[model samples]
Target: MNIFDRSKHIYLSPDFEEIIKDTIRFFNGTPVHSISIAERFHGTGVYAIYSIAKTGIYSKFHLVNRTAFHIPIYIGKAVPKGWRQARQGLSENTRSYELNNRIREHSRSINLGEGLDIGDFFCRFMILEGKEGDLIGTVEAALIRKYQPIWNTLIDGFGNHDPGKGRYEQAKSDWDVCHPGRSWADKCQGVPANQEVLLQSIENFMAGLNSEEDA
Candidate 1:
């Protein structure tokens, strides 16, 4: 019997791994800017949002990212519109400024949050184009896997949009419960998450990060 089974496994070449590493390095080297400033740029790519808010449950998060933004509270990607439908080709409107628009939307969300201040948020983004644009989702997945950001992993719905008419049957997102100001989220008829439980989750997550660093 053959010891190695090549038929059942997929191989990942070292070069392929290097490409992902290089892409991550490029993204990390991009300048960090305030969310307002970041929303002015035009391109489709991935971004990381860091919080420096010292409010109640977020103070620990602020301390970790205050000096250098090594930790991101949220990581997300913005792809060109219709890219999903086209799958293989670029959209006809390549200059749609999807990345900028997405960041602008986030700014609006933060502004609406009762406890979140727009001034405490910052972001870093890489505007990938041409062949590199195809790697946008890949890069975003890699970052989220590496950091396991609070918004991306633990607490969800930071990236959600209002489900239009008659679609409010689902439970309200943990994020909506904690932040509590997006008008449409109020209409969600299902059970809402306990804010205390979400805060405890955030506390535990921060503790785990501390343990990892101490190790």
Candidate 2:
């Protein structure tokens, strides 16, 4: 059964999220609990909300959470069926997480020496010393263009996520499946109109940054 068909709804997109790969592993630095939660629990019950299962037979069943990370990462949620179909709809050139170890590997940037913050999580996280955004954005826009129609159908079907109130109850089939690849947008599907949504996602993520400025 589709996981979203149940009472669970992800507060944040788990389809594609940037996490300190080390956070989920015994990287000889991070904590065991953090890695355990990331692996066993699937993700921090916090920002990058996800659905998890203990075993294969009863898989679809997952617990919803929001505060599951000590690192800041962005979650990419494509149209609804995005996770359902996997990379089958993408181009043959479409990157596959299953093909390489990097796809499922861990990442680390800043050590959350303190704990976790929601607004902090929303803030923009760039890489390659700022160049990461350019490379990432370009790729995202391309995919959005190729999958325009299907993308529209999925986002529309997933429905709207309230700015902060919690579950967007209206989504059709929410799941915490891993993203097919990093930067799924690869430039917002190449649609000029779609850029706005991508921007909104950025805006939503940087909510904490906004508050800091206000302070």
Task: Give the least accurate 10-residue stretch of model 1, judged by summed lDDT.
Answer: 206-215
* Candidate 1 CA-lDDT value: 0.84
Instruction: State the lDDT at 29 in candidate 2.
Output: 30
Which candidate number maximizes lDDT?
A: 1
TM-score of candidate 1 to 2 decimals: 0.88
For candidate 1, lDDT tens digit of each residue in 39-149? 366678999998887876676666677667878889999997667886634455655678998888898998998778899999999988778888989999999998899
lDDT of each: 0.84, 0.25
Where is model 2 more than 4 Å wrong at Cα? 1-129, 149-159, 165-215
Which parts of model 1 are misplaced by more than 4 Å?
Answer: 1-9, 87-94, 211-215
At residue 181, what lDDT does model 1 achieve? 96
Alpha carbon lDDT at 108, candidate 1: 92
